[model samples]
Target: MTFEIAFVLLSLLGMVIALILDKMRPGMVLFSVVVLFLCAGILTPKEMLEGFSNKGMITVAMLFLVSEGVRQSGALGQVIKKLLPEGKTTVFKAQFRMLPSIAFISAFLNNTPVVVIFAPIIKRWAQSVHLPATKFLIPLSYVTILGGICTLIGTSTNLVVHGMILEAGYEGFTMFELGKVGIFIAIAGIIYLFLFSKKLLPDARPDTAVPDEEVEDGEKLHRVEAVLGARFPGINKTLADFNFQRHYGAEVKEIKTRNGQRFVTNLNQIVLREGDTLVVMADDTFIPTWGESSVFMMLANGKDTEPVPGKKKRWFALILLILMIVGATVGELPVTKEMFPNIKLDMFFFVCVTTIIMAWTKIFPARKYTKYISWDILITIACAFAISKAMVNSGVADGVAHYIIGLSHNYGPHVLLAILFVITNLFTELITNNAAAALAFPLALALSQQLGVDPTPFFVVICMAASASFSTPIGYQTNLIVQGIGNYKFMDFVRIGLPLNIITFLISVFLIPLIWPF
Candidate 1:
């Protein structure tokens, strides 16, 4: 009822709108909120900037680098090629084999990279075997998410939460601590995908085995092709300069340079050049306009070709990635810890070293490899920490926690634990997993203080629930990656994921108290 409270609520509402619209990136949205609060004198400058220094933020950045190293080393690609079946396998057997393996790999590697490396391969294999790619992609993304919950270093979400816990003066999670619930969740998930997924999953598009080269044939939108001519005013200009929506009312889907560089059209700063091919989605009205423009040499009707990394670069990238994983594991051991107390062998350290080494080795030509890293994701994570700090410092999280405990007063600890698991899981589905953990963490601490019990079990629940992002594709980056490549509709994920979500929720509720003992 207080005006200040109302303002904070309004600010949070703004954040929700931003997330739903998704027109602006999450980082920009969170950052805008921070600035609004700061201007309102709700948060100090120190508080606004504090997230930048948080261990959680740093760990996420490091994980991205480590993932890049693995990607550059070509380790993931090789593994996918080896593990994926070639032909003549039953759909059930293939799903069982592929989902679990991908899940396990995602436990250590970044889930996004795992999906990216495997998506095309799975698509190709699905075509060759006369199976639907849609059937497997959602399962692939879901299983990886399930597997990421299994280890301390499995996903950046865990590390971020662990770092936040350490900052709260509690000892952070140990390696495999989450495995208590995570393993069961993974098992349950694998079971759901293996047994019921085929029945529930939609085969929206038949297995046409459209080669990466032939993705154009399946294009549903109106296609406009523009050839870059020498006098093209747009040449060397970024897409932003073209004012694409203003000038053509058409969205650029893909850009292909003469050199074979190809990518989704959202890349804003890529300079347009002569003799380049642009795959644009527009109405027929714009085609004549595009033809009249001097910027383009000609218009064509076809899908853009997929860019293939060099064979030598792919192999080297794979080897280097394997080395990063092995090295990070070795570096994190008790012996290694004792040898170098000052140097922590965490995701950040591993990623930094691996990125540097991969760049030096020119595994994927360091320059291009650098571009592969999702800078937006890193910024989003850092801003998420700031928002979390704001929530805690503003006493909002504690107030929410008090309200929750008041409601659960007569419900007992088991009921309270289940409630916490459900709340965390729902939050994770709505927001970034790391953001979910950050928001829930302060509540966990507050609840423990009120209940006069150990906070370990509560923290464990948050970690497990935060990483259980199975209900929606948009909730997790890996899911989005697979959704596009697998050509799956939104409901395909929910059909298979809803059961796995329930399974994980039940498993976490039962196991947390027994394992960590609140």
Candidate 2:
């Protein structure tokens, strides 16, 4: 290997190690790698920073605002209520009823917020009806992931790949292009969950249902459920360190962690994490006080949350979201493309328009817009583009592609496709999905060129594999959200999600080339 290629490979190995160890935020780790590339002359200054101005990255930022608008409008919360059955139901029946629709809804919104909003409601409903919350929570997280793969704007990873495609001078994916293959995987995966999840998933009994009338010292105490967000000041700190009761005026009664365990006895000593769920005892003001706060992703009282936004505002937010999706879809059609040859009326344009409208109309708090977007993810994506460029620039991607192709050339591209899928999926399970796609994109691009085949199949596999992160809770943020709420163990995810992961893998390998062609 040339010194440049050797440097890029070693740097990438270090990046992966840093990401896996989580020694720093993913964006910073990636940004550090890009800077190193720039210094080594592997990437020009413009090439290193081009991702900051890339259309795909900006679209992701806008979608975060759009998602926040819908989340604030209380529309998703209402939808979850309507989906759950009114009475006691079997695990299969409950999953069958909500999983598909949840997947569909998730296709249009960010998966994390979708899970954040729905998890508490579903958990409470399952307990009320005598079903295990554990049965439905993991499925809820999995379906959102399934749904995210259905659209270009479904997940940040799709937009990241789409950005890379545009930068490479190829026609980027349409809003519904991924849906062609994604729908099948989603349907099949959901069916797999419906069939096996009931047996494979553990059934952890929820804590005793909280009573509405817990009179203590002649004062009424209400049970408030709060799912900690990244912004929570006390993350990685004990309750005593943060003075949870003194600051929030709510006494934490039980703490559930992402490892599928709970700490009720040593609440004061337990260290807090982003996805931990806390059942606290407080007065009526608990929900209203922290309802819109950034510290908690979701806060609910008993089985319900505070009143949603005004009906008119809720309807307007929903309509705006629908219009954005339809507009982006139609813009990508050949007829529309021909009419607007000079101006690309695409997702980026519609999202920009929708975000401004939502801000002006106050769907989400406009002034606090900065808080809605995950800057870390955007940084990670922009840096991802830079890092992918470095790989291509250094010839490392081509060298690795040739090595991989040599191993499987006799077996044909099908084997190559499967191999690429396994690598990307494993990385996603170990790190973040966007980071995985970033690491894999250049190799996939080079492999197609080396084999004299269209890169479309390779591109499609990257999208699918990077998103099929079901084997572990840490792979996807949605899984972590549900882990604590459901009280699921690490092995619980392995048991059920491993099978679903395999199902998605088989579908991607056998089905993608047929649709996009190699």
Query: Per-residue lDDT tens digits of candidate 1, residues 177-240?
Result: 7887889888888887888988898775632222223235563456555555444566667887
lDDT of 1: 0.70
Q: What is the C-alpha lDDT of each candidate?
A: 0.70, 0.88
Model 2 lowest lDDT segment of ten = 207-216
Taking all chains together, the TM-score of candidate 2 against the true structure is 0.94
RMSD of candidate 2 to true structure, Å: 2.3
Q: Could you tell me the lDDT of residue 369 within candidate 1?
A: 49
Give me the runs in candidate 1 sitting further than 4 Å from their true place. Answer: 1-4, 207-336, 368-370
| Cα lDDT of model 2 by residue, 89-187, tens digit | 788888888999999999999998898889888887887898888889888989999999999999999999999998888888989899989999999
Clashing pairs in 1: 66-351, 72-317, 73-317, 73-318, 74-317, 74-318, 75-318, 227-297, 232-295, 236-272
Q: Give candidate 2 misplaced runs (Cα > 4 Å).
A: 208-221, 238-242, 265-271
